[model samples]
Target: MSKMRPSKKELLEGMTPSTVHANEIANVASGELGLEQNDSLTEEEKMRLVCSRFLDIKEDDLMDGDYFFTELDSGKYDEA
Candidate 1:
């Protein structure tokens, strides 16, 4: 007999950052943005939210190629 597979909700609930760095980044991003930890959101999404918050830009404004580190390194969001 075949075993039953987990549902999407179950999978999402069990999901976690694949690496230590990813987890750290997600935690920092969420804390900085005053957001609660959301398991449904990917690491990229969390970082995008951080970038959007700091840059005063919409999350939709960031493209796939855009990264929070790149934006932070660019210093565009630094207060004058």
Candidate 2:
């Protein structure tokens, strides 16, 4: 049996880059213009709405004052 050759997509695999070049590539891949710190929640109401939207429950359930909410931190998404 013969060994299979690498596909065209694999040509750039394992290519090493200096710290500066790596960061430059990352910037191009990320189309966003602002820095990491600039991407944040500035408004209080917006923050509450955004956080609340993540809940899988129905919107009507949220209206009930007696409903107890528990924040579940599962998987690496929280860290991301």
Most accurate candidate by lDDT: 1
Which predicted model would earn the best TM-score? 1
Model 2: residues with Cα > 4 Å off, grouped in runs:
1-24, 27-38, 43-46, 49-56, 59-80
How do the residues 1-80 of candidate 1 rate in per-residue lDDT, one tens digit apiece?
33476796864674556623555545665455554335457889989977787876677887665577688779978999
Q: Which ten residues in a row have the lowest lDDT in candidate 2?
A: 65-74
Error of 2 at 77 (Å): 18
**What lDDT score goes with residue 30 in model 1?**
44
Each model's total of backbone clashes: 0, 0
User: What lDDT does the true structure give each of the candidates?
Assistant: 0.65, 0.55
Candidate 2 lDDT, 1-80, residue by residue in tens = 33465785685576766423656655553436443334554568568868788878777666444333223333433566
Worst 10 residues of 1 by lDDT: 30-39
Q: If scored against the real structure, what TM-score would every candidate get? A: 0.24, 0.21
Report clash pairs, candidate 1: none
